[model samples]
Target: MTTFGAILKAHHIDYKLTNRSSLDEWFYSILDIPIDELSIFDISRSIRQDVFLEYVLPRAEVFLYEDPLAGDYDGQLLYDISMLTEAQPPSIMAILKRISAYLSQLDKHNLDSQSIKSIEKISALVRN
Candidate 1:
């Protein structure tokens, strides 16, 4: 298994030592500021698509599953993800297929309207 640090290293995203229990926490800790206030484009511009697929994409489910509005205050995983997808990286088809599956399994009834809208946008974007 690739250590979370290894993935961050692969992306050239630097971080200081910290006490974090999970990969999710470690992922957030590296960011200088909140992801919502940051531009996904800026953060991921230099990231290799293959590395994104191998490391980031596989973690999409864990990220989305932490929807803040749903009472999970983990962070804006979806926010960054949505923006990244909107950027239309070369492996977008694979991204769409992977994230679409995550979105599909969502209990839409439990999601707030805004969340639903966001998911719809992502889904629709992938289709086009």
Candidate 2:
């Protein structure tokens, strides 16, 4: 998991970021401070745009819901980020573009109801 993902997990937001890289330990070390005291500024300073795009964005699920194809349901990564975008480190347009590209390439028929709802939520983000 990427450090950013770990941060969300620490906050009780369960989004799985599947990038295992050399910098993982270095990033993890930054969290030695109490999780409750960690601020958005601290997170922004610790992570970069490249890391957010490459390691975090791709696997960020839109919604977490109980469905056979949906895996475990706990939280929505994109939704969580969207809710906190005012304090988010990465550019909103960058996030929107990446999500657009992902949706464009996806097979709509393969999506479950929760996934569709997830898509809807993200689409709402675009409108906003």
Candidate with best TM-score: 1
**Residue 119 C-alpha lDDT in model 2:** 59
Candidate 1 lDDT tens digits, 1-128: 45545566677978665656564363455444333332333233212223244344544544455542321232244444454444556565676667766787877787667666666766776776
| Structure candidate 1, residue pairs in collision | none
Q: Estimate candidate 1's alpha-carbon lDDT, on a 0 to 1 scale.
A: 0.51
Error of 1 at 42 (Å): 15
Question: Candidate 2's residue-wise lDDT over 1-128, tens digit each?
Answer: 24555656667976433456645654555534543343443333332333443333433423222221332232234334334332334554456556655554566687666656655665666655
TM-score on alpha carbons, each prediction? 0.48, 0.37
